[model samples]
Target: MDSEVAREQALDAAEKLFYGRGVQAVGMDAVRTASGLSLKRLYQLFPAKEELVVAYLERRDLRWRGRIAEHVERHDDPQERIPAVFDWLEEWFGEADFRGCAWINSYGELGATSERVVAQVRAHKRAFRDYLAGLVTDAGLADVLAGQLFLLAEGAMVTAGITGSAEPAAEAREAARSLSRAN
Candidate 1:
């Protein structure tokens, strides 16, 4: 395979293993095996495990946010768009391999030991919050509503992950609606 394809294959395997199991639990050889790439090529693409972790995070962040944005954009009503965020979350939580927020999971697994992991988590979260803020602004809601919505969404992810239920997304959406009305 070409270098770019090999790189993508490595990341695909790394993301699956890292997110499915704790990052520390999976070894490079596992990624190598999963990707069907040789050890030398894997190392050539990612010099260290930390580099692989970073790449996994970076790709997941972009892909996750893009999916959410696309989902939200499907709705025409501004008010509906806000709730659409939770709607998307609900669908995500229902997936067979649902594993909660990748950033949150990554932080729990490796943030203390890996500053790169810590930075990636923080950056992803900050960007998510900013995205919420944009939605709040576009909806002509109070500025504070942005923070509340962001918290609601994060809380739903954690709750769903812990309890193995997708109901939190709907619950959060109701709360967001109530808060939006109060604003």
Candidate 2:
């Protein structure tokens, strides 16, 4: 298979197995079997299983942002967009395959063993936080308001993780709307 096509297939399988199964439980062989690629092909695309996880995470970040932007484009108001953002997340949280945020799951799975992966996860998180922070600020919320909304959003992710329910995203959206009244 072509490199891009091969990479995509690998990522698709990784996402399914990683979320449906745990990251640590799924190994390179599992991914190789899932992707229908030869062992050599899998190794060529991903030198290590950790490297594959990082690639999987990078792909998740792209798709996650795309989900947010898809919802946001349907509305002009940033305040409206904030809840819409959570709406998308709510859908994801409800998915049976969604154990939690893949990136976050990977971070916890390989914390001390791999500093490189951990650093990448932190950067992804920082970028996410900053992106939402900017949106809050743009919606005319002060730094304090922005911070509060950010915390609430992060809390929603954790709540979903802990409870395996979509309620947290909806609650977070409602709370974000209330915070919007501040602007």
Candidate 3:
């Protein structure tokens, strides 16, 4: 296959194995086998597992972040904004392959060992926080409250991941609605 196709294939395999199985458990050979690509080809594309991991995080982020930005723009009411996030979560977590947030699960599976993956995860977390900050700013919300809501949403995601259930998302929505009304 061409370099582009090989890279994408590698990324696909890496993302599933790395996220579902954990970065440490899924070796480069496994990714190669999963992608039906040779070891040399995989190395040509990624150079290192770190590079492949960075690609995996980028791929996941691009998919979710774009959708999130679209959802955020779909409504003008700031009150409607926070709930859009939970709505997206409910829909995604309801998927048959739902294994909770891939990012958080990967973090748990890797702990703080993989600097590259950890950095990628932190960047994604910042993106989420900034996304929430944007919504709060748009709505003229207090900075402190905005920070609280951001953390609350994050805590909810972590909870859902821990329990393999989305009840926390519903709880988050109810809490968000109440907060919205207060605003």
Best by lDDT: 1
lDDT of 2 by residue, 89-183 (tens): 89888987668776677778888798877977887778777877777766777667666766887788878988989999999988888878866
Off by over 4 Å in 1: none
- TM-score of every model versus the real structure: 0.98, 0.91, 0.91
Model 3 CA deviation exceeding 4 Å by range? none
The ten-residue window of minimal lDDT in model 3 covers: 91-100
lDDT of each: 0.94, 0.81, 0.80
Q: Write the per-residue lDDT of candidate 3 for residues 1-183, one digit (tens) a residue.
A: 788988899998988787677778899999999999999999988898878877888899989889877876798887688888887776766666666676787677664778877888888988888888888778887666576677777777777766778788788888877887677
Indicate the residue-level lDDT of 6 in model 2. 94
| lDDT-better candidate, 1 vs 3 | 1
State model 1's lDDT.
0.94
Position 68, candidate 2: lDDT: 74
Off by over 4 Å in 2: none
Error of 2 at 97 (Å): 1.8
